[model samples]
Target chain A: MAEAVAGCVRHGLPAIGLWRQNVAEQGLDETVRLVKDAGLRVSSLCRGGFLTAPDFEADNRRAIDEAAALEAACLVMVVGGLPGVVPGEPLGEISRDLPAARERVAEALALLAPYAAERGVRLALEPLHPVYCADRAVLSTLGQALDLAAPYAPETVGVVIDTFHVWWDPQVFEQIGRAGREGRIASYQVCDFLSPLPDVLLGRGMMGDGVIDFGPLTGAVAAAGYAGDVEVEIFNADVWAADPDEVVATMKNRFERLVVTRV
Target chain B: MAEAVAGCVRHGLPAIGLWRQNVAEQGLDETVRLVKDAGLRVSSLCRGGFLTAPDFEADNRRAIDEAAALEAACLVMVVGGLPGVVPGEPLGEISRDLPAARERVAEALALLAPYAAERGVRLALEPLHPVYCADRAVLSTLGQALDLAAPYAPETVGVVIDTFHVWWDPQVFEQIGRAGREGRIASYQVCDFLSPLPDVLLGRGMMGDGVIDFGPLTGAVAAAGYAGDVEVEIFNADVWAADPDEVVATMKNRFERLVVTRV
Candidate 1:
């Protein structure tokens, strides 16, 4: 977490999205102090979900406490998949009961939203791509995410639009407009999609290397009234293995050459 | 080419899609005879584009000939990307001129449609996912494919809706309905997306294993007036490496358990 923050700070990045595991590893208080001392904005915490668990109360409260300690702008929730885990295997498979899981997630969000708002931290529902529908998030589209956030005030709960996940969406522009009208646009993450990928989880392209037309995408978001800083969140192993400074330099260069040119 | 066809035949699979290189390897005359002997249908000839070439005439003409000889029901066009080859590398890179490439593909399709119709072969405009918008089919949506095919008679040119590509599309049902209403639903291929996949190309799942609600999708296509056979096309390396008989058995089981139940 500190390495990622230091890289961003060196690269002159304005904000950083910290993952919960990282915060936990460093101790939340110390992590917050480090970020604060570095004068970096916590764009949002990486996540706080899995509310579909049978034991929701304990998990949800702990998540709230962590988000509060981080002083996160938003807690980006990657609502968990199925109920249980098999021995020796990771718990990343979806249960057959999607509608029920969605309902549980919504109920948990409803419970947490007020608490989050009172603490001055927005709870952002990050709708993952449909590919992640089985194991990560049931909310797969921008419309669905916005719909989930519909009952809550924008300041309480909103949606995050990650271009890697949502760029393939035909209704992206219209949904961005809808999100804007509803004031649900929370954060926008940009990345490209190159084919014949090596790792589904980590092979995301740098900003301008793939096929997403970012200019029109950002334009649509801006037209929808979003004026937030564009976040470059790539999960590429290739990028991660490089010197962190080089990675940030490449990200910054791609941001200017590819993304900025398009915008 | 022979291996694919033999597998299809041995498996009692009704149809198989073949790439041009595969066809070339077996020689067209023997390949046609082999397919006929197996009583298998040629669902689609793998591809017929790369139309962005300065001289589209040669590639286009050869593709038409192959499709005609193979007696393919549809010539699935993976319209090419950029022009020019960087020596020693496959001519597979993002095209600098996307608009021009799109136009070239449209022009080539327009020119080939008549010949395809004359040969009783349908030209299936495959709208690839936007991930391939740089170096593959410029047609990135069913709506866009339909728009491209609008000028031609449905009998001459139609659209191929591959579930692997279009399953995530929010407007899928809308565009599918439109295709059905216009009598342009040419071919429908079924596959599933497995998240955290090992390889994007070969990791497509068997029907029920992934996130796709194929029941609703198949029903929508039937409602759209499509009466064609649902081709169970999986590109999994594990499945391919397994005994072909087992692959067939698994596919058949999935069809009966999932697809048949839905339809």
Candidate 2:
């Protein structure tokens, strides 16, 4: 975590999105101190949703507290896949009730919204690609995320516009517009969608390395007036095998050439 | 093809969906004769869309003629994916224009609808699961398929409601309702969604063998007033490797217990 903070400073990047596990491992206070010492901003905390768990409220409250301490932009919420997906096992339809699972998310949000608002931490609902609808997130489109965020105050709950997830959606641009109008464009993450998905969960490629046309999407975000930090997330195995510095360097280059110019 | 027809007769099944390739290999006339001899109805022809291909028109017309010759209910259209995905090569974003690919489908449908209509054949637009949005069919939802079908006569352009594909959709029941209202439910195909999707293309499991709650969906189709042949399509490797007769028997057993009762 220290190295990661230093690496961002070293690479001349402004912010970083920290995963909860890493923050737990690094100790929250030390992570905050390191970021503060490096004069770096925390773009957002990695995740804190999995609302399906029995202990969701306590863990999520802890995540909110951690995000508050870090002064993170928002808490990225990957609101769980289905009711009972055991890790390291084949995904089963323990319950094939998707609507009920989604309702659970809405109810969780209602409870968490005010708590997050009190901490001044925005809960960013990350709508994963529909491909992950069965195993990662029931929120599969920007439109669905916005609908879930509708009843809550925009400051209390927002949405993450990840290119890899929403690029395939037909209503993406319109939803981005709605997100902006509603003041809920919490974060804009960039990555390319690869094919013959190497790994369903971690098949994202660096921008320009896959099939996404960044110009229209980036321009749309810009048009929607999302003047926020653009985080890059590539979860490919080959990219993971490369040196961290090189990966960061390539991300910056691709963002500049394929992403930034659009805006 | 002969065995499939014979098996259907032996199993006391009334109808079967025919793939164009299998029909050609067995000689189209012979296929028609075999089905006729066995008193088996050709519920629908396998496919004819791939609208992105340069030869889509000629081929689709041929498929239309084939469907007509067999007196099939419809020509199933697995509208092609992105424009330039080579068969054995990695799926590249040779073009990241999904909207454009979809537009191509609309255009192809405009031209072919009249042709299909004259032949007394319905072009059944099958909205493949969104996972195949990039590599199989640009039409990713029943709503989208319905929208595309809206511009034509219901008989000329209808939609296939495949449980394996549309089961994950939040708007599925509503769309099925709309399909009924629009008189566009041309076919109802069934299969189960398994995970760790064995192979993206062939991961479909036998009904009741996976997570699909067939009762609600089958009930919805039945409620939509679709009194058509319920086609069983299990593409799993294990099921495919099993004895064909045994496979048919199991499919019938599962369908009776898990699917038929729902309706």
Identify the candidate with maximal lDDT.
2
DockQ, structure candidate 1 = 0.21
Model 1 clash pairs? A215-A262, B50-B80
Q: What share of the reference contacts is kept in model 2?
A: 0.36
In candidate 2, stretches whose alpha carbon ends up further than 4 angstroms from where it belongs are: A91-93, A261-263, B91-93, B261-263
Q: What is the C-alpha lDDT of each candidate?
A: 0.75, 0.87
Q: Compute the DockQ of candidate 2.
A: 0.54
Docking quality tier of model 1: incorrect
Off by over 4 Å in 1: A1-12, A51-61, A80-114, A194-196, A208-213, A261-263, B1-16, B37-39, B51-57, B80-93, B96-108, B129-135, B138-144, B171-175, B208-213
Taking the tens digit of each residue's C-alpha lDDT, what string does model 1 give over B82-147? 454222233355554445566777888878787877777788888875545545556677987898
fnat, candidate 1?
A: 0.16
Task: Chain A TM-score per model, please list them.
Answer: 0.91, 0.96
